[model samples]
Target: MATPQIHIVKVQKIYRTANREVHALQDIDLEIYAGEFVTFLGPSGCGKSTLLNAIGGFSLPTSGTLTVDGKAVTKPGPDRGMVFQEYALFPWMTVAQNIEFGMEIQDKPKDFIKTKAEELLTKLQLKDFRDRFPKELSGGMRQRVAIARVLALDPPIMLMDEPFGALDALTRRTLQDELIRIWSEFKKTICFVTHGIEESIYLSDRVVVMTYRPGTVKAIVPIDLPRPRHTTSPEFNELKNILGTMVMEEQSRHQKAELAGTTAD
Candidate 1:
């Protein structure tokens, strides 16, 4: 087998407040390979985002190690690009400008940035909106631009934190198809976090289901379904039911914890 591109070992993260410590992640050990698509799925507060952040080097693990291509991830770097649900684009910049922003920051040659920006604009079907600003576009268009901006950097690994969670169902499914196309064409290693069971099963080579608070891997379910999956198919529904049960259990645990905390207070 090929060596893993990302190796995480016994990773843990703790967030402290004045009165208490919140353990966000605990003993997470996994390996992700190059050009693979993996989804982190679980209930709210399960540290799915935390784990994705750790891999992107947005946050440090309190214990254990995270490495990409044999190098420890210490901080955010060009090797990994992150896409958030909020569509973190500059409102002041045009679609073209937003796509070129990263390359411009790196002082990439103007010609190269222009060429790359144009390439992504066309690839993402944003050529028509290149002159528009973020506020002028619809939510779906804004997200497409956000994705184009990230692709401009050509990072080998993309970290997405529920990037489609806020969109309408139709738009979400459309973007999911777009993402799959990009992944297949670009050969990127993507780590995605989402609360949608169908989304997880539809997009991932494997779905990593996390437990509730103090989150750790509850199960790593490989999605063996073929591409262009039908959500209503028997096999798809079977997998969805299984994942739904796992996530529902964790959510129940989270609800119980909340009640206990409230009682104690």
Candidate 2:
């Protein structure tokens, strides 16, 4: 087998303060191959985003290591691009300028930056909105810009933390389809964090289900369904139920904790 593109080993993360230590993650060891789509699925506080942040070099693990292309992930680097839940775009910059910002930061030649921006705008189907500011665009359009901005640098790995959670179902699925198309074309190793089981089932090659707090991998469910999957098909619904049970277990755990806290109060 080919060596893994992203290697995480024995990863543990603990958040310490003057009063308490919050154990966020433990015993996480995963190898994500090049050009694979993997989704981390779990409930709130399950460390799904925490793990993705660690891989993006935005969060430091209290123990163990995260590496990309044989390099230790100490801080945010271009090799791993991140798309957050929010668009994270500059309010003042136009779409073209926003897309070209990274290239400009790298001091690429003016012509190169312009060409790259045009190419991305065309690819994302935002060519007409090149001069428009983010506020002028709709939610879906803005997200397309956000994704185009990330792809500007051509990172081998894309870390997305619920990038579609805010949009309505129709738009969310539309973006999912757009993302699938983009991933198919570029084949970037994408690690996405989501709570929706069906969304996870639709987008991922494998769904890594996480448990409740101090989270660790509870299960890794492989998805063999074809592209443009029928959400109502027997095969797809069967996998959804299987994944749903695992997720509901954690959710039930959370509810019990909530009820216990209420009783204590």
Candidate 3:
């Protein structure tokens, strides 16, 4: 069997404030197989983003270990590419320039950077917008540029944190299809975080349900539906219902916890 692309073992994250400590993650243990797509599905503040950050080496866990491709992750590197909820494109740069930013920072050869940037622009269907600025493009088009920027690095693993959360329904759906197509064609390992149950089920090979804050894994639900899944299909709806129920239960439990805390205070 192929090695796992990303691995987490009993990871925990804690934050220190002036008056108190915050537990963002607790005992997160996950394994993302190489070339497979996985998603962390949970409500807001569930530490899904925290876990992704840990794997990307942008944040360190208070305890436990994170490994990618059998190497310990201690800092951010080009091997793992990240796309945030907002398009972090440079407004001053053209689309092609934004995509080449990483390469430039790494002092990569100009020929290689140009070739890779052009290739990604073509692959992501953004060749026509290569010279356009973020302000000149639609939200979906800007997101495509954001994704292509990360893809230009050719990371073995891609970490996406609600990259489509800002778009409208129709635009989000279009980007979803585009993402799946890119994933299928590139076969890169992806760990996507989202609050959308249907989106998780549609995009992931396995949907990992997480608990409320101080989060831990609630369940890892495997999606057996075939590619190009139709949301209206019975099988798809069934899976959706299952995931929706899990999320609802977690949310309810979290509300109860919050109420108890309030009453005690």
Best by lDDT: 1
**Candidate 3 residues 1-265, lDDT tens each?**
6667788999999887767777779999888898899999998767899899998899988999889988999998888899889888899999999999998988999999989998999888899988988999988899999999888888888999999999999999999999999898888999999999999998999999999877899999999989899999999999989999999988887788777772111
Winner of 1 and 2 under TM-score: 1
Q: Give lDDT tens digits, candidate 2, residues 139-207.
A: 889999999999999999998999999889999999999999999999899999999999999999999
How accurate locally is residue 90 in candidate 3, as Cα lDDT from 0 to 100? 92
- Highest TM-score scorer: 1
- The residue-by-residue lDDT of candidate 1 on 120-184, one tens digit each, is 99999999999999999988899999899889999999999999988999999999999999999
lDDT of each: 0.93, 0.90, 0.90
Query: Would you list the clashing residue pairs of candidate 2?
Result: none
The worst-scoring run of ten residues by lDDT in candidate 2 lies at: 256-265
If scored against the real structure, what TM-score would every candidate get? 0.97, 0.96, 0.94
For candidate 2, give the lDDT: 0.90
For residue 141, what is the lDDT in candidate 1?
92
